[model samples]
Target: MVVDIFIPCFIDQFYPETGFSMVKVLEKAGVTVRYNKNQTCCGQIAFNSGFWDHAKAMGEKFIRDFKDCSHVVAPSASCVGMVRNYYDEMFYNSALHNEYRTLKKNIYEITDFLVNILNVKDTGATFNHVVTWHSSCASLREYGLKDEPGILLRHVRGLKLVEMEDKETCCGFGGMFSVKNEPVSTAMAAHKVEMALKTGAEYIVSTDSSCLMHMQGYISKHNIPLKTIHIVDILASGWEL
Candidate 1:
């Protein structure tokens, strides 16, 4: 059960703990994890910004980096989604088309890999706080992840998993969208934070760190008591923060 861990650029830069926490959860479940330090971004941001030439080069490098791994797991749904769903198209008509397509079959977002591939429902996690799960737009629509997080959360000892309204709504962290439309992004994130606050949950959890980052921005600015947590952080809490 050796797995290759793909740390997205954002996670590598801002939330490295979540990546390590994911590895802890996997190892706790009796899985061996390997990280390729040479790995870099999945080129999702460049692709989304319509820089196909640059993104293709980045994607090619990404394929070369993880093409040999038996299984590729990433905590960021957006990066995993880009690699799994979009890379094929990017590689179409290119020499690396088959290589990229083959890699897609092995790439899995953390939750999807845990629930679907590993058949792991829980990581023996325990937390006393009440938490709400945020279904990031990419996780919900792109990855089609609906119940995986819920299944894992339910098994945590002494943790209450509450559902917030409009869980499917985006947290306004569509990568460049947040930067291009700051006001709208802030407004959407504010609404999302408000919903989490109404639940009286101490933490709002999501698989996507970008969404949490956006929502946390608003939460921090308004001095909200809520804390944004990645799902892996919650699951790996059984070991230690």
Candidate 2:
């Protein structure tokens, strides 16, 4: 199937490799993926921070960018959740509401699209190391993406998926929450890192890069050996022992 890839701001600027890997995975799976250079922010930051007007404008731009595509997929669940669940509210009474609705239905998180639409579990990846999965709040509770990732991860040739304590707990990177409540955000991230380290996981994998970025900051500050990875990277690296 043909799909439009939505690379969030952070992923585009800081984690371009993940976007590249996502494209590789999709191409390998026999899907035609297109990247729209005009694509910009999903207006999630502003929307969540209570700036509906700014968010509406941003959402309008997003709709304009991908309105013609059959499906729009994002590497970050947080962004997917934003577009899928919040765009309508952000543009409810605006002229763009109809376009917003169309964009919302076509958007999908990478994992959700892979498992649900692609119908393929194993990406044929092989990373011979102990790893644990972190369920970001958006991907887990908001999008109800409980099994798609697991179904895919389990099939990696030599990867061992371990369960950590409080697997469903937020990594404490609630967008603006991290900036507004640094102390609380850091504390929760530290706790989440502690649990992942306790499992002796060589890597902490998740669907959201925001969580990984937050955890990585703490992991680096504290000199923790644990590594953070996006699910797309892992899937793309499939069975490469």
Candidate 3:
């Protein structure tokens, strides 16, 4: 019932509220939450940018940061995917191999932990707005998280969930992929927003804030009529509404 939260760079710097919301949702489920101040990047950014050396350095630090924790949960599937899937390549034969393996088994995406680990179907939330889910590539493909998010959202009171055109499509915020290909990334975000609008959704929700940030940037820059929100934020909100 005890867990440690791993907040990635994106959420720590930009969407700290989402990180706090995740902790709130977990605590609401009657679980003990711990924040490791020593935690840092999961080396995903460096790994995706093709800097394995720099990534390995941070990966070591990340492993050491959460080495003592029983369970490590993150708000980001992208970062969890990094730790669960990619850490092996860097620590396979190294001294940190065993520790990284343990980290992989212990880490869970917030929603995944809620539905699977915590066996929680609802967090007593009441978001009375239209929402369409965006399946980040990491959330859907890498982490293979499909129903956990939907299962949790369906339980929120007065929340209307709609299906978008490309529910399984990428939001174009593939970490370094966005920076390396701005036009394509923007086009992808635009397409995603267009699809969400078609659903008449008041918010585009996803577990990954990176995608939200990308779409929100486009939504803001072009003055679009759409908004973006993280899944944890939705779950943490609406009780006071």
Which candidate ranks first by lDDT, i.e. highest? 3
Q: What ranges in model 2 sit over 4 Å off?
A: 238-241
lDDT of 3 by residue, 125-231 (tens): 99989999999999988998979999999999999999999988888888888888999998998899999999998999999999899999999999988899999
The true-versus-predicted C-alpha distance at residue 217 of model 2, in Å, is 0.8
Better of 1 and 2 by TM-score: 1
Residue pairs clashing in model 2 are 124-238, 124-239, 125-238, 125-239, 126-238, 126-239
Best-to-worst TM-score order: 3, 1, 2
Candidate 2: give its CA RMSD in angstroms. 1.2
lDDT of 1 by residue, 107-154 (tens): 999888899999999788888899998998898888778789999999
lDDT (Cα) of model 3: 0.91
Give the TM-score of each candidate: 0.97, 0.96, 0.98
